[model samples]
Target: MERLVQTIVQKRLLPLVLVALVFIAAKIIFALITIVAADEAYYWVWGENLALSYFDHPPLNAWLIGLTSIFFDNNVFAMRLPTFLTFAGTLYVYWLFACRLFPKAPERAFLLTTIGFLASPTLFAWTSIVYNDHLLIFLSLAATYAFADYFSAYSTDERTSTKPLYAGALLLGLAALSKYNAAFLGVSIAALVIAHPRLRTLLLRPHIFVAGLLCVLMLTPVLLWNIQHDFASFELHLVDRYDRPLFTSFKADTFIRYLASTFIYFGPVLMIPLVAIFFRQRDLDQFGNMTIWIARLMIAFTFVTFTALSTRGAVHWYWGAIAYALMLPFLPILLKNMWLYGVHIVLGLTFVVYATVNYSYAPVELLLGGQSSEVARVYGWPEAGELAVQLERKHGPIYLATTGYPTAAQLAHTLDRTDIYDLDPRPSHFSFVERKAIAPGADAVILHDQFGNLEGTAARFERFSKIETFVYTAHGVDINKFEFYLGEGFISDGDQ
Candidate 1:
């Protein structure tokens, strides 16, 4: 026993194994306690109704959730298992990449990278939530590792084999299927290929063309879906999301917010090393140069591209998690200062603790004008679904409706009903949820809020009878308010 323990300690395998186990445990616990956010509920609905693609994101997240539902019965924690598993996969891929990047001290590299992942608020929290980014992050990193392996193997032996390239291409394609942002990986690869003469030769190879074809084949689902839908998804992302003119409004302010959020979400301690790596770049040894270059380029390209986009509209803080993750291999560069390194770990762990305990406590009223608060999204949803069920029981199968996708989705999941209509102009996955509008002149129950357009919602019905108001409260603070109305006649859009 002593010999086994000593061998493990000497190999530094104990810490790595402990960290992985601890991370998995923490994620499982957190997912169990974490309230299902609106986007998560929305995606769960997608899983309930399997499809080729969705309006906001591709079908991978939904597919994972759907598969998990088969086993876990759509429990919140079970629904989140896919994200946790993918994040774990992401960590292992990072370990492989770090080992390749710093072969001299692979164990230490992996240990520090795992710690860095836990320290980042976004990365840590993302593991507990089901989102498309989790899949994207895992597949993108896997693709990155495959390319690094290919570069190292090809450069060392000048082998013309195409297996690694094909693997990388397939992973990249899957990453793209997870989220549109995976395009950054392709750009980073192109930049690396263009900058490295040896890699640039890949462009002329027939195998490279074959790899490209593989990526295109992987993306065929998204393309075919878009074509069938008249590219509504493209318009939603490229045009609808950017409501403001580029460079014409609050450019500096938005850019500053983006940078500040980047620092916070990435963890301030990790940012110090990230910025240091950004400015103090140098060529790694021949075998690792391509890997390092791709990392640097991905970091630069993602942040810089989003920085520019932030000028036009809000760029979410979590969007930069992947960029911060790419900084793992360079973390050893900071180990020269043990005190700072220690502080980095301390700060990161502290943030993780703080976020785990208090991330869902935001108290806000349900409003329709702009972004709703975390409390508004999480709280009162179950009660609203329950209320809808009671109303349906009382009134004999009334259509349940709401004014927004978030409410519609959360309530739908709680009630296990897909017929809830979002009676608003905004486009959502509901458009493809395979449900017809409540028949004209049919009775329906509308969940109304004070701050929402009650007038417009009321206008959709010929008459409404007010029901009791439902309030979700925590610690003497009301988190959300819902006013229920039983409408006598539902009016479809064409009726007016």
Candidate 2:
């Protein structure tokens, strides 16, 4: 028993334990406050419904969040728990990949995994939210790990492992169902197999057949969902891709900015070492050719895709996420370099302090629009609920209005009302109205402060004798005000 314990400790259990501690501590600190953003609330609603897909994302994250909330109840901690789990799971998987690849430098692999986890802003931020991105990230890393294992066997030995290849294919299929971005993993794997001489034998192996079968099996549900829904998922993704020329004058500038931001967001300390590892192929070759191929494929794909998409809105996070797992191999080497290690420590401390300061009472007033006393009061759902209740009492059937689905969902959830409407002027159900027509007699209007041309709407409401406003805050941040107006046409009891 004593020997087993020592064996576990010596085999990098300590690092794994430390990773868990960091994950739990970060989550607990963040969950002490109310939900920090609208996206968090929107995803929570997805969990409540437990659907196969949402208007914006796939169902994996919603399912995870729903499962977590079942145990903890629908509060901040419950909503954010899945994110914490994803972070922990991601670290563990990365460590596993490192161990398999760099057996000689296990400590280096462990350190790199830790640094990569801390440096990724998208990973950090999404981990705190109940969103598809978190779940997608987990599956993506898992798929990469499985692929590494499958291909590694070919280089080391003449025989191939059918299990790992099949597992990887199944995971890849599940990942594709989770999010469309996962298609890249398939492309990366195929490219690696075709390019590497030793791995070409995989084409003749039964594992290929098994992988194909597994992918089809795992993807069956998503395919059915798409078929039933007129392939709305595919259409949504394609429509989102803005049509732009391949090369533009600003391409170089935009790509450079994205590259720089990736370094900053991932933490300069960790990024420096990651770059060093890429240049030192000898250090990386110790792992396996597939590991190196996966890393190179991710980087190459991201740059090419981002370059093409830059002419449209440059969304860096999506590309950055694909490269996350591949970057883990170099983290330890970066830390071993004294200069990079010092920078990383400083950056890590800065992030903790910044996060803490955001929750401090001194900043609460300013952060929550200067009127709210309690951070929870400002950030919580009560204010919105109260406004909804009051409006319902006066108006026969109150209808809520918002520019976005998240805001609409927030009001609907808090007020215990589903008649809530979106007033974005596009085709939608609920009560549809122009910005200038919001008045008490026409029910209530919920408008975000960021909305332009409020003067017209306010003037129309002022014409009515009944006009009231309520303020709401989320996590001590005042999101917007709810304006209720009773127009001239409003009748007393006898008028009916």
Candidate 3:
């Protein structure tokens, strides 16, 4: 087995091709078995609604989901096919960029980097879901690649064509359409142009401004939608989301949380060497290649910005995934010892096993005494959907609702009904999607999760029927408990 592994790693193309195929196959298998989470179901509903833009995000993911639905059913596997494709595309881009940055590195070093990325537990487990991040990461990486290729070519050959620059700009537009975070990509590009003397002269070229215009043109729909809806999306992302004043509350715990998340996202194997390299070099230019310098800037800017945000408030762990992903090219630095390579191979395989088990079995729920929101989101929804159907049948076309957007959206997808109302006052994409509001004194059924809003939901109705508690169990362990109530009469808030 050792000899066979060595032979595969030594081969020019075998390791990359073999690992990629296996990784893709695993994604397929995982997507097939894993149930859809609330956010995914919410996005799936966006596919059903077919909107220009949404309250929470741009329309690109909703558009992709709509396209996926045309070819396949609304099941988890079908909806997530686009994400799988994008993940593969991301890997391909990383391969090209890594090879370009490390021309002196051996084939084995490149292969090791590929294995490290595919086996990162965070990405391996998380990327299977259909999210705007998948599209954002892929397009942003592709755009970065195009810009890097253009710069590298232009530096060597003055007569290099501007096709790559244009392509990069077009992709950056798509990336922006994917998620709001792509603004960071634009910042990186602007910074790269300003810092690099050779590329600075391109400011005189007319094509650069044309490319920028083309990118801005793609955002017309987003701008139009925001105009139609009072720019709520921008307000939500920019102002409403940040409750705390920036840099006012710089907590050590939050900063540590962000740092730890960055480490885990890179995976244990690569994170160690990556930190060592950073500490040893302590300068971006030490990476030597201009292409690498761009990625390093991305890593520095993303981590530093998020680290500050983390000090202010809780930041999502995966927000820095793009930065961590860009560290793939640097993985070749770990190839100094054959023993390190062997250890990396073992660790990579181990991560794959860990992800497969974690996704399928969900041992974390057991460890946490069945209190994982991640587990709860995926399970109990189908049962809740069925209960909603039966309740509506008994109640005779009454309104269905839940305390939160996630539950409401999951119920909508499960029952194939878009009229489900979220009783919570908190705004979500459902706020924009048109549905018949429940009139005063109308009958309605509300579903509440384990998080519990029984009294709050009861206040919205004149009176409540007997509440039924339903617990969903998997493998002899209870996953989540939900309360189903048949309300006597619905009372809409003044705003509704």
Runs in model 3 deviating more than 4 A are: 1-24, 102-110, 251-254, 273-288, 334-351, 362-364, 367-370, 435-437, 451-456
Arrange candidates by lDDT, descending. Answer: 1, 3, 2
In the range 84-131, model 3's lDDT, one tens digit per residue, is 789878878876765665655545555666666666766665677887
For all the candidates, what are their Cα RMSDs to the real structure? 3.5, 6.2, 3.8
Q: Write the per-residue lDDT of candidate 2 for residues 258-305, one digit (tens) a residue.
A: 767766766666555455545645545524557767877876676567
lDDT of 1 by residue, 1-496 (tens): 8986786689867865676566557766667776788788889888988888888988888898889888877577788888768876987887786676678777777777777777666887776688888888888888887887787777667665668889999999999899988888788887887778777777776776788789888988889889999998988888787758766776677678888988877777776776676564554666466666777888888888788788887788777666666667677764456566566656766665555554355432322234355545577677777877898788877777876677777777887777787765457888776443568898877776643456766777888788768887666666678887887787777986
lDDT, candidates in the order shown? 0.75, 0.60, 0.73
lDDT of 3 at 464: 86
In candidate 2, position 355 carries an lDDT of 52
Worst-scoring 10-residue span by lDDT in model 3: 279-288
